[model samples]
Target chain A: MQERLGKWLLSWPPLAYLVVFFLLPSLIMMFAAFRYPGDYGGLMPLTSEDPATGKLVLDITLDNWRDYLTLESFVRLVDEPLYIELFIKSLWYATLTTLICIAMGYPLAWLIARSPKKYRDLMLLLVILPFWSNFLIRIYAWMILLGPQSALSKAINLVVTAFGHEPVSLLFTPFAVIVCLVYVHLPFMVLPLYANLEKHDMALLDAAQDLGASAWQRFWKITWPLSLPGVYAGAALVFIPALGMFAVPDIIGGTEGIMIGNLIKQQFLETRDWPFGAVLSIMLTGGVLLMAGLAAAVGRGKQKAKQKHG
Target chain B: MAKRQSWWLWAAAALAYVFLYLPLVIVVVYSFNDSKLNAEWVGFTLDWYHKLFNNREMLVAARNSMVIGVVSALAATFFGALAGIAMHRYKLRLLPFLVLTPIAIPEILMGVSLLIFFVLLNVTLGMTSIILAHVAFCIGFVAIVVRARMQGMDNSLVEAARDLGATPWQAFRLVTLPQIMPGILAGGLMAFTLSIDDFVITFFTAGVGSSTLPLQIYSMIKIAVTPEVNAISTLLMVLTLCLIVLVSKVSPGALRAE
Candidate 1:
């Protein structure tokens, strides 16, 4: 029928795009991770390799997985003091950045959502304008600003001299890493919080106030509870990617500190260890998905509890 | 009433703004700094801007990024428009989750997998490959934005257009297109920005010689930071700002509308 044909045409384009480009490529790549290259740099099937050729003998062996799970490799990657220390450092940095973003963004979102219609656009623009630029450029700018001789450092030194205090080294540390991550991801945090906050029915707060509740009381009871979804959303948005971040640490974290993302990058590009790189990618992906899954479960549980209590 | 309302919120907001804009402000200022140190402000000069304009390599990278951006934006918009329509008009089971999986996948995994896939196929990575990669990720963004517009659309307009004996294409072109054009434009601009700004994925999928602006910047930074780079970044920031504004202005209620 013409109708059926029309419907098929309507859906085919997008479906084909997703299937061909996104899904197929990803599946192929995942499969490639399981095999080694042949003479033509093509993936060979299991049992197809000639014993004499020794060209990445593709026996569908568990060698790749075994290599990753070996005690030495495990010790090197996980038990190694440096990787564990850096992982902890990265976790805390991401945590601090997430907290800072929430602390900064929530009140701003509240202000924008509550402000008069005339000034709302101005406030939102201020919040989002920084994100308009490239993320790398922003971090690079931070490097310029926070470097020892930079204007910010110079200004702080001047003040420190005035007060007879020592000028602090703020750049090239965990402090700088957190600052950069918060700066870059702040808008992502703000936008979602703004969305959730703006959706709050003003009349509910009015009712809370009408019940002789103090302004702070109304905020704690009504506003805070209402915006918790946004807060969680904002925190997750900042925290998830911040953990896997590469450039910020590379540009600003200096030699002493590095993120796992940087390690993954090094493995792939600098080290030229494709198999190890694939394993690391899988691990990092697993970590992100695990965290996201936990967050979702917690969110659902909280919602269910709230429903029951209400 | 005066006692009940504290200026704490306002103060917090001001500090947050300061934290956010200080680096950007420094970047803009240092782009015109007379000296190369990027530390001290020697004097204002247009020398770096001039250098940026004269650099052929930088210009080539910028061109590559622009080409990728435009192609990806248009492709994403087209496919995303259809996906959005399918999600909205047709109640296809399991389609929503399928569309969303692309976003959930860590961008690094997506990048690595695609790299491996291209290598397996003996496909040389180039501008075309970059465009393909850009579109793959950008489609999800386009879908989300277009879906937002679709949700807000009143269905009656489409029905009325159909009732008036307009063909399906005519109905889409005349009624649906005009209504969602803002969303499409917004999505397209976002796609362009994201594509141009991307480095990591591009680094993985892009061929050895195919240097996007971000890739070039990445390599340059790896060598060493430069004030000339600052000047380039400042220009990029300004351009991105203009594009965001243009897109936002077109799409009223586009911000936080989703």
Candidate 2:
């Protein structure tokens, strides 16, 4: 009995912590999403709703869900030219950023991974060192660089002037936002790629070369294929956060660039349209989940084929 | 050894590093600029930093953000360490799967859901609410770091401690804690950094009166661009970069060195 009591006490810390803070609060929030608001825009208790209220006053109606799921809302979202454009723009930005990260990260990861054992640890630390800074600060710094009177802009203008061209406007646009996002999230892409790439054996590359395979052929056949898993993981890592990014776009996007996350923020904060905002949030989340599911499925299929071949 | 084409790879990496650090370099330089435009090459001046220190609201906001960051980091590390221990020692039903869901969920959803939750519970949004939100997100990061450390740790040490007539608590305190202290410290730093950097969720849930530094910066930037902002931003960037370097120097696998 004393032993059982000791075990229970030992378990109490984590269990009590999560249950009180995480589980309870999350459950309450999930439930809050269901109920209707009463006077003063407060949520009425779920069990105390009227049954036969046709006037839709102080009653439980599936109104929020209906408002979200209706064809009109769908059509309204779909018909809006900006929504689809922003959605597509978001996809392209995320995809392009992921690719760039891979292109840049793979070789660096390779170099660091295959470096002399003594310096390899130091190299890896340097690569990840930039991430410790606040993410917002980094993005904010980009604004200073790309702004009209900033150092980067001034330097570029001088170079262009030497080449006999007018100073070009580069800041406060989609290009600026993409550049900032890619720079900010590059560490996320690199770390995972590095982790996986470090696992590949050096003997395989040597074996391929010993078999008289060309350098390009050996890379395409051996190195690239093996590192594809990391590439996929890296892509997912960059793409997921990039898709839902807001602060970067809001800061750097200025006029020409805006993403779906910005729209969601506007709905919630500026517009005060809670129902519509909730619907948008649900849709955006659903879209991301679907994309992630599809990516996972593709990854699984490729892994299965690799397993079969091996 | 098979030598591959390394030129392109080297160029790409060099370019990438330059791209990553250029903005940071610019921020550091512009912080001392005499000109307010942040574009022109003005002579060095510490006036902005002087103004930043003297400003009452700015000082208050910085203090508030620091307080929140310290509290949230400690809370997150405490809870996260407990969770990691639970996960390591026991095979609790549904705990692993449930914990992983927060990582997969969109940040905005978490933000909105928490907003609704607090509204329903009639809890006022303020410093405590912001701290609570920060801890929720930060715990996942701390748990992941601590769990990784736990994985490499030997269970025999705990067994040996217990066999010597130590309580479970004593065994953990003397045996396990020392082994994973680096990871725990690294995780705590991560929590501190993440909590300080957060904006989206905090923006949604922060009370009317409680203004964090990020929230403060966001509002300032939205209205107009100022050299004061450039100065503030530059300071922030340097501080963050320094923190990252410090953290990396302490932990073996904390930062990927290049």
Candidate 3:
């Protein structure tokens, strides 16, 4: 009895707290998505006039849900090429960012993991320390660097003058947005990859080499396969948040780089279309969850197969 | 021959460090620049820092951020420690997964959801609501850290205490709490930093008159990039770095690569 009471005392507070503060809010938001938008930025209720008393009574209806579920919103989303283009563009940006992160992060992670033990923590700190700074300020730093009249641009322009070429515009462009995104998320990719790579058994490589396999062949057959979990984790870490990113694009992305996150922001703040924004939020959430699930499944499958073989 | 090839790896790592630090260095260096705008370099001056000190709104926003960060961290630590201990000590199914939902959900989704929730509840959006929203997300982080710590802890110590005639509360207080205290403290520090640096969720949940530091910096930047912003950014960066160092000191492997 005492143990059960102790368990209840330990568990119930956080469970109740989360249900009220976190889970309840999510449920409300999901429910609001199906209801008609109220005049004041929430769900609306149906109302009808009472016949005998001549008084109006409020009621709930599935009409708002039916309106959205009738294929209109989805069709509208399809017909609107801007939405489609933004979705595709966001995906392309995330993919490119993930690829760049892998290219940059893999080597860096390998170096840190392979570094002398005494200096390893310091090196990792160098990577993580800057992330402590405000993310917006970090993005703003890029703005300063890429500004047309800034020192970096002037130096580049000075070199261009020797060749009689024009100074290039760099700020407020898709290139700038991609650079910032990669800069922001590179650590996420590197950390997990480093965690995986650091534990790798070097003896396997030495054995493969002793068996007369080339370094490239050893990497492909042993190291790459072993690092698959980390690759998936790093990719997921970069890809999901990048897919839903708004602030980076909002700040650095010019007209050409608007994403779905920006669209959702506009709907809530500018358009004041709460239900539509909810729909977009739900879709983005669904996409992110799906990606995370797929990554988890793939990791499990690989582990199971490895267990079978080993 | 292998050493020669490995030099390329070292060079790539060097370049990566340079890539990461270059922007931060620019921000810090330009904070003292006499230039009002970011485009050009003027002679060094402390005018921006002076202006930052005199700015009332910035100071208020900073105070608000600190208060919210501290309060939310405390709240999250208390609740998270309880849940984490329970989950570790008992066979409570389904609760762990539910706790993870807040972290898994996108920040924008969480932000909008909280906004809608507050509006529906007829609660005025202010510091209280913002703190609640922060605590909601921060609990999961703290819970995860504490749970990891508890899972690795030996159970015999608590059993030994109980066998020696200590009550359940006394056993936990004397044995379990001290063992997991570092994890709780580390989780609190992380939660504090996360709250202080948060922008998106705070943006949606914070209505008029309750802007946090990041929100303030963002609005200021939207209007224009001034040297004052750089000074404030440098200050915030220093504060965060100090906290991270303290966190590392508190728990050696807390911020390890994993």
Name the candidate that leads on DockQ: 3
Better of 2 and 3 by TM-score: 3
Q: After superposition, how far is residue A123 of candidate 3 from its true place, in Å?
A: 1.1
Instruction: For candidate 3, give the docking quality class from DockQ.
Output: medium
Q: Which regions of candidate 3 fall more than 4 Å away from where they truly are?
A: A40-42, A45-58, A61-75, A155-167, B1-5
Residue pairs with backbone overlap in model 1? none
**Cα lDDT tens digits for candidate 1, B1-58:** 0123358988988888998888888888888999978777789899999998898989
What root-mean-square deviation over C-alphas does model 2 reach? Answer: 4.5
For model 2, residues B203-253, the per-residue Cα lDDT tens digits are 888988788888888887777766676677777766676666666555666
| Interface RMSD for each of the candidates | 2.3, 2.9, 1.9
- Deviation of model 2 at A23, angstroms: 6.3
Off by over 4 Å in 2: A1-58, A61-85, A150-168, B1-5, B245-250, B255-258
* Candidate 1 lDDT score relative to the true structure: 0.78
Best by lDDT: 3
Give lDDT tens digits, candidate 1, residues A88-171: 677788888899898889888988888877887788888878876887888887787778876678888899889998787777
What's model 2's lDDT at A206? 84
lDDT of each: 0.78, 0.73, 0.85
